[model samples]
Structures are given as structure tokens and as C-alpha cells.
Target chain A: MFLTVLSILGACLLIAQTTVLARMPPWLGNPDLLFLLVLFVAVKVDTFRGIILVMIYGLMMDIFSGFVPGLYPAVYLGLFLTIRYASRHVIVDEPVHLPPLAAASYLFCSGAIFLYMTIFNPGTDILWSWRDLLLQMFILAILALPSFHVLGRIAARIASNRRRIFSTAKGGNRFIS
Target chain B: MRKRSKRTRPIRQFLVISTCIVLFGVLALSFMGRKELTLPHRLIFDILGTAQSGVTGIINYVLDIRNDYIDLIGVKKENARLREEIKRHQALTVDYREALATNVRLRKLLDFKEQIPQPTITARIIGRDPSEWFKTFSIDRSSSDGVGKGMPVVTVEGVVGQILDGGNHRAKVLQAIDPNSAIEVLIQDTRTQGIIKGTGDSYRLHYVLRNNEINPGDLLITSGLGGVFPKGLPVGRVSSVVSKRRGMFLDIEVEPMVDFSKLENVIVIMKSNQLTE
Candidate 1:
């Protein structure tokens, strides 16, 4: 389990490096590996580890990015907690429509970004246009989906195989012991 | 215990979705009107910011070369064309000299207030911040050039933003187009007094009296009310006027004279003879 989480963190660091270095050469769009990790934990991980990972991820982000000290970590971790709590009690249908889920995720991300900026910059006069944010969110999600699909498949394979390994252990208790 | 079947999950699903949606909205709203972004948040923003500036530099470089740079075969032709244009402009300057001299003398006779004497340094705007929300920028000049905080910066066109911070050889300017920037302005014709501000898109004339005799197309100039700015510098032109009988204050929109976003080169005005401390 520790190795798995470490691997995920390693991948995220790689993504962050790419974001800073090769990133959309002249394009301002930097991919959010943080968001990807949050979504992965919220959906794939269960139990206390999921919640712990949220805080861990948020802290890592705070340490790495130049956002306000506590804002993003608190907000993102809060999002993770909300997602985790919901997943505990609710059943997400498999073969679910990806768009709605993507939209929901996009909304969550926007809210987090907005909250962080608004809270930290009180006196700064900024026109918070919901229309602009919504438009940008949808567009970003659409772009993210192509990449998300490939990652999602890899993720699902890993998760399913992990489940298989655990269940086999359950059936062969005497032999294993 | 056997796990609960999926059949009973949707009711629970509705409740969860509704709760999550509500929680997100509330969290988002909680962030509104926050006073200061914590240091960590600012750091993340800066990293992203640096990356953004890097991108802007690349884009501007490419755009500049595309617009002006040409293949070897075409370079000479372009250069010659620019030289001829410059020569024509020089000839026109000679023709305008007499009238220009007259305008200057008349302005002196009218007793245009003397520009306060202070030491000054000039710099060029090198990079603009990625997020318009911050309304900040990085310039090429810095401490090595004697730039420092609280120094009022201006362009050949008009007052830009002040120097907020600086590095060894580079400085950051808070552009006048930034929503956070506020300047005192006077209308050219009416001499109407009001504060000029930016709304991230354009400059606005705010705090005008409801009954002020203002109209569209009025030229707004710096009143020098703030000790930071020199008098009579062009600020912007009044773009719109809002009048409602019961309205507590007049809503006036002014378009800034300078295109802050497209700012490439700028002049730094120093109070005459003042040196960087």
C-alpha cells in the first residue's frame, strides 16, 4: 500500500516537472496532476487512507506551489473529504456517463480555485465572473478527458488486479499461513 | 455481513450528491472577500506565475519576430521601408515645429504647473502577469537601475503603476490597469474631481457626485491630488455616464489612455532630483 501511494506521488512529481518545463511550450495551460491524484484517491481508495492521502496531497501542493499557505490544502482536502464521505454511502453506477462526472469534477476544481483566490485577496478588486469560469472549466475538462481516458484504464487495471490479489488471499487462508 | 445491494443505493446517491454539491458551493463562497492569501498560497501562485511569464515571453518573442522579422530575401526590403517611413516622419516634425513651439509657449504662459523636480530612471516592461486578477507585472529594470518601492512610474503616454517590488536587475510594476490601482483624476473640461480605478478590463471614474456635469468623451487627466503623480498627465477619456435620480452616486466609466496589457516600453518619471534611497 505504501509503495502504491509512493508510486502515485512519483508520477505526480513527474507531471509537475513537465508542467513547469515542457508545458504547452507557449500555451498557459498547465495540467493539474494534483487534481488527478485527488480524484484517484476519492474514487479508488476507501477507508482512512483515502482521507489521510487528501491532507497529504494538499500539504504537498502547498509546499510546492506558491498559493497561499493553507488555502488550497484546506480546500482540496475538504473536497476530498466530501468525495470520500459521499462515496462511502452512495453507489456510483459503473458505465456512468463521463461528462456529468467530469462536469462535477470541473465544478469542484473551479470552486477550489475561486475560493483560494477570493479568500486571500480581499482588498484586491477582481471581477469574479462565473460565466468566464464555467466556460473555462468545461473547455479544460474536455481537453483533460482524452488524457484521462488513458490514465483511467491504467488505473482501473491496477485497482482490479489489486482486488484480485486480496480476494485470492482471502480464499487461500490456510495455504498462505 | 453481506453487502447492501445496488438497488437501494440510488436514494442514498441522491442525498450524497445533493450534500456534496451544497458543500462545494458553501466552501467556495467562504473564500470570497478573504483579506490576504497566505504565504504558501502566494508561493504557489508565484511559481505558476513564473511559469506563466515564461510563456508570455515566448509568445511575445514569437509574435514580434513574426510581425517584423522576415526571411533574408525580405529583411533588407523591410528595413529600407522602415527607414523611408522614419525620414517622412522626420520631415513632418520640421513642419510641425513652429506650431509645436507656439503650443508649448502658450502652455507656459497659461502657467502649467512645473513638473516637480526629482531623479528618475527609465525601464521597459518585459513580462506581464498571467492572471489578470493580480494586475501585476515584471519589468526589465531593477535595483541595479536605482528603482525602488513607492516610486511613481509613468510612460511617455501617461501614468502607469508604481514600483511595488524589485529584484537585483528586474522590477515588478503594478500596472494602472490593475483593478487594485487607484489614481486621482480631473476632467479636462469641467475640472470635475474623481478617483480613477481599473476593473481588470478598463479604467473607471468613481465617486463622482450624482449631479456632476459630466458627459461622454470628456478627457480625464491626472489632478496630481496624490503626491505620487505629476499634474495634467492624460489619464483616460470618459466612456460612459450613469445617472439615476435616486442613485446615491454616479456611475462613470473611463477608458485608460494607455493599453496596459500591450505595454512594451515605458518611461519612469522621478520627482525631479530625487534619488533612490
Candidate 2:
């Protein structure tokens, strides 16, 4: 059930990213809503399910984006696993951690993309602009707290519903085993 | 407990090994270009493209209505301005009549029409590239509309880009201002040759010798050397030229004639036998 909701959210964000956000003014920058969602899942959801959904998000990114078919999935899975592991030990779940985490993830993802293209598709003259990357990071940082807040609410609701179902099945009011 | 740990160890090892193998396989497959889309990808593209078209159409309609309202606010002033402009153009039409006659005679003498009646299909832009690195966009026309990859796209102002790929109902265009794009061009006044390459928002002309005299306002038109575009199509004007003391070539910048930021419509050349190599 949680996977279904995340999948639907991913699909909606993909559609809007391709259709609406793509049309926004070039200078304002396009925030990676899908990337934020993946981070949200990694921090709030179980690792196994979060990784699976992040992989799906990557596949959708590959489709909507003009990149190679499997490019995004590989990059996204790596990022997802990294974030999943880091959140276990670090205090990365709070809203205040959103800016730095978002910036780091954005740089990692963008750098990985450039590296992959450079290694695989040699002689492809890619214009690497740090200005554009910085602009995107700034926008993502601004959006991170609000975006995570909404995703956290959804994750909490899903978790509570699962707890309720489990308790009802065991014929007990308290969920503690 | 020791015996159970022993049993789970092999399963864990197998899962780890299998996961690594799968990821490497996916990466390898992606590393090699997959030109053909899987059936599922095609189906998804079809559905999403249709939805995008519908949503874009409605959005454009609302925007047009709002623009109309804005235009109404200045309609009277614009009407007066246009009336004066028409009078000025009417006076200029007499000179234009003579020039048109001269142009017809010159064209006939040069057999211009014999090799230049190219057919073009108009297309509307539906979406733009989601990423900033690759300057590309999707247009409403596709293979079903007689559009195909490698077709040159242009607008009334000048060259736009080339068709990169096509689904049944839509096609993706790689814009002229992308890093991957390159076009052979000639300076209109001096006939100097150089390659115009995309540098994100603008174009940069390359390969001209450092000693070459190129003014900032000189026009750059397609040389048609590679047969992708026809001869004499406007590409851009040289916006700036810098002669570096260390390099053998000049660092020249071109301001594209067509404003990509404002592009909403384009024309795709269907066929021109004279231009096709």
C-alpha cells in the first residue's frame, strides 16, 4: 500500500516535471522534485521499499528525460542506498538538515551524470556550467523543507495505518509486540 | 545459533553477489546506446505525449485569452501606431514594387526556383528539455506527420534545430544552442568559414584563424557543407570576437537569429533534393 502511494506520487511528479515545469523560465531553474521524493523515501521509509521506489523513480526519469534508458536508475539507486545508510547513523531526518543534504545530493547526482557521459560517450561536448548547478541547488534547498514536510506527513499516515491493521489482526489495541 | 548463522551466511552472500551482477548488467546495457525503445517505453510515451498535448493545448488557450485581454488594454494606441506604420509602408511599397520586379528577373536569370521549392511542415512545440545540459524539446508533429529524425527545423526568423527522435505523434528536437549541435557556416560579408557550436544559451563560432577580420555585426549563414541544412539560411550574427594571445583561433560568439526562449512554433523541411547529399 505504501509502495502504491509512492508510485502514484512519483508518476504525478514525473508528469508535471515533463509537462509544466519544463516550461518554466530558464533562469528560475527547475527543481528536481523526483530527487527530493527519493530522498524523502530514503529518510522516512524502510530501506528495501525506499530503494525499490527510488529505482522506479529513476526509470521514470530516464523515460521523461532524454538520457539513456538505464542511466537514471543506476545513478538514483546508488544515491538512494547512500542516503538510506547515512540516515541510519546521522541526524539527517530533521527539516533543518534539508538544505545541506539536498545540496550534496544534487551535486552528487549531477556530477555522476557528467562522469557517466564523459566515460561512456566520449567526444560529446557537454557544457558544464557550475552556475546552473549552483542555481539548481539553491532552488532545491529553498524547496526542501516544505517538500519534506508534505512527504513526511504522508509517510507517517501510512505507517500509522499499517500499525492499526496489524493491531486489529492480532486482536489487540496496543501495537507493541 | 551458530548453525543458523552458518546457514544464513551463504544466502546473504548469494544475494549480495546477485545484486552486484544485476546492477553491473544494467549499467553495461545503458553504456551501450539503446536506440530502440522497448514496447513498454513506447506505450508509455504515447500515453504521456497525448496527455501533454492536451494539457499544453488548454494552457495555451488560457494564456491566449489572458494575452488578448492585455492586448485589449492597448488596442487603441496600437491601432493608431499601426495606422501610421501602414502609411509609411504604403510609401515604401512603390520602391518595393520595383525591387520585386528586379528580384524576379535576377532569380529567373540564376534559376533560383529550379532547385529551391522545398516542402515544409509546420509544428507546434509541446514541451522542452527537462535537463539544462541537453538543449532539446518535443514538438507536436512526428513520423505520422511526415517528420523524421535529422530533419532541419526552422522558424520565420531563422534556424531552430534538428529532429532528434520521433514517436508516432510527437518528436524531440535538439536545439541549435546545445553543446552537441554544430553547423558549418560562412560569414556573409567576408565569406569566412567557421563551425558554429552550441554553448548553452548562445552559439560560438570556431576554427576561423585568429587573424581573420570579423566584425561584431557580420551575418553568419549556413554553408550547407554537410548537407544537413541548405545554403544561405540565416543562422546568427557574430556578437563578439576575441583574439586570444595564446590560441591559433579566435574566440567568437554568435547571437542566434531565432530567439529560442520565445520559440512556440517551427517549420520542418520535409524534402529538398538539392540540399540532401
Candidate 3:
């Protein structure tokens, strides 16, 4: 049930990203809501559930963004696993770490994509603009904490609803018990 | 803790190994340039495309109302200016019609065969690529509308792009400004042939010899060498030309005729036989 809710949320984000956010001027910098969602899942959701959600988000991105089929999934999954491993050792779940963590992860994904394109698809030229990269990082940093907070609340709400449903199914009292 | 870790180690190992294998396989497929859409992808695209179309429509409608209200602010002065412009255009239209009639008569006198007009379908832009690196967009037309991969999409101004793929009721367009896009074109005045490659924001004319006499503002039209795009369509205009002392070719930049960012409607030229190479 949580997975379903999160998937719908991801789909809505993807839709907005491709439509409304895409229409924004490049200088304004569009926030990557899906990437932030991946980060949220990595920190809050369990490993198996988080991996599934990440893959779904990655596949949605792949379908919309690039001609390459598996690039986003690979990048996203790699990031999810790395963050999962890192969080096990470090206290990265706190809101204080979001800005830098989001920025670093964005850089890592961008670098991996650049490397992949350079090595595999050499015929195409990819202009590396530091200004654009910095702007995206800045936007991601600004949006990271708030986006995570909202996603966390949504997850909590869904989990609570599931618990209530399960309780009601077990013949628990509706209001008092 | 050691015992628990020992029990789960094999499972973790298996998961990691399987992930690596799947990643490798997927990367291999991407490297191979797999363009075909599977059944599931098509279904998802249809659903998402419909949603995008609905959202775009609502946004456009709201924008139209806002623009209408804004336009009302200076209606009197704008009306006067447009009235004068209309009068000037009316006179020009007469001269243009006379020229067109004479050209038609000359063609008939010279036994010129009339070219069959290609069937075209108009598509509305539903969504755009979210990535900065790629210049692609989704349109409302699809394979159901006779829009196939490689079909040239154009606007009233000039060439927009080519169809990348067609879902059930929607299709993706690869804009001419994408780095991967290449079109065969020739300068209108000098007839110098070159390949136009996209440079993200603009185009770069390639393979024109250093000796070629090309200038900024020279028009470029498709040479029809590639079966994808039809001949004589306006592609872009030369923006700059530079001659390097070492290279065999001149570095020429082109400004695309179509402003991709402002595009909302496009026409897809349907060529039944030339859908794919």
C-alpha cells in the first residue's frame, strides 16, 4: 500500500517535471523532485522497498529523459545503494546533511552520466557548463530538506492509514479501542 | 551478530551479483541503441501522455485568459498600429499573388510536373524532456496518427525535428537542436553543401571546404540527401564563419529557423515508405 502511494507520488512528480517544471526558464533552475524522492526513500524506507521505489523512479526517468534505456536506473540504483551503505555508517538522515548530501549525490550522478556518455556515445557532444551545474546544485540544495520533509510526512500518513486498515480488519473498535 | 551476518552473507552476495549482471545487461542494451518500445513502455507512455496533454491544455487555457487580459490594457494603440500594418500587408499580398500566378504559368508552360503534396498531421506539444542535455518533446500524435520514427516535424517557420518514436497515442520528437541530430543542407545563395549538426542551442555547419564562399545571413535549406527530411525546407541561416589555418573545413555556425522553446504546434510529414532506414 505504501509502495502504491509512493509510486503514484513519483508519477505525479514525473508528470510535473516533464510538463510544468520543464516549461520554466533554464536560468530559474528546475528542482529534481524525483531525485529528492529517491534520497528520501533511501533514508526512510527499508532497503527492499527503497530499492523498488528507486527502480520505478529510475525507469520513469529513463522513459522521459534520454534515449538511453538503462542509464537512469543504473545511476539511481548505484546512488541508492551507495547512500544506503553510507547511512549505515554515518548520520546522514538528519536534515542538516541534506543540502550537501543532495549536492554531492547530484554531482556523482552527473559525473557518472558524463563518463558513460563519453565512453559509450562518443559521437554526441555534451557541453559541460559549470554555471548550469552550480545552479542545479543550488536548486537541489534549497529544495532538498523541504522536499524530504513532505515525502516523509506522506510516507508516515500512508503507513498510519495502513495500520488503521489492518486494525479495523482485525475487528478492533473503530473509535475508542 | 557474527552468526546473523554469516547467515545473511550469501543472500547479500547473491543480490549484489544479480544486480551487477542486470546492470551490465541493461547497459549493453542501451549501448546497442535499442529504440523499439516494448508493450509496457507503450502503455505507460499513453497514460502519461494523456495526463500531460490534459495539464498542458489547462495551462494554455489559463495563459490565454491572462494574455487576453493583458492585451486589453493597450488595446487602442495596438489596434491602430495593427490597422496600419494590415493595410500595408494587404498591398503586399496583391503583389505576391501576382508573382505566384506568373510563376505558376511559367511552370505550366515549361511542362513542370506537380509534386505530390505529402500528407501531414498536426500535433500538439504535450511535454518536454526534463534533462538539459537532451532536446526532445512529446506530442499528441502517434503511430495511430501515422507518425513514425524519422518522420520530419515542422512548423510554419521551419523544421522543428524528427519523430524519435511513436507510442500508441503519442510520440517523441528529437529536436533539431539536439547534439545527435544531423541534417544535410546547402547554402541557398552559394549552393555549398554541408552537414548541419546541432550544438544544443544552435547548429554547426560541417564539411564545408575552407574555399567555400559562405557568409553570415546566408540561408540554409535541406538538400534532400537524407530520406528523413524532405528537400528545400528551411533549416537555418548562417550565423558566423571562421577559417582555421590548419583544418580542411571551415567552422560555420547556424541559427536555427525554428525557435524550439516557443513551439507548441507542429506538423508531421507522413511518408509511408520512409518511416525507418
**lDDT of candidate 3 over B32-124, digit per residue (tens):** 866788776799999999999999999999999999999999999989999999999999999999889766644542331133267677778
RMSD of 1: 41.0
Q: Which lDDT tens digits does candidate 2 get at residues B131-211?
A: 656788889998877787888888766788898887898888889999889999999999999999999889999999988
Q: Candidate 3's residue-wise lDDT over A51-84, tens digit each?
A: 9999999899877886777888888898999999
Regarding DockQ, does 1 or 2 come out ahead?
2
Runs in model 2 lying further than 4 Å from the true structure = A157-177, B1-116, B271-277
| Model 3 alpha-carbon miss at residue A84, Å | 1.4
**Model 2, TM vs. native:** 0.68
Go through the candidates in order and give each one's C-alpha lDDT.
0.66, 0.83, 0.85
**B47-136: candidate 1 lDDT, tens digit per residue:** 999999999999999988877655766878889999999999999998799679756644542342234355556566654443213466
- Write the residue-wise lDDT of candidate 2 on A80-139 in tens digits: 888877877998888789888998998988888788778877777566799999998898
- Collision count of model 2: 0
Error of 2 at A147 (Å): 0.4
Name the better of 1 and 3 by DockQ.
3
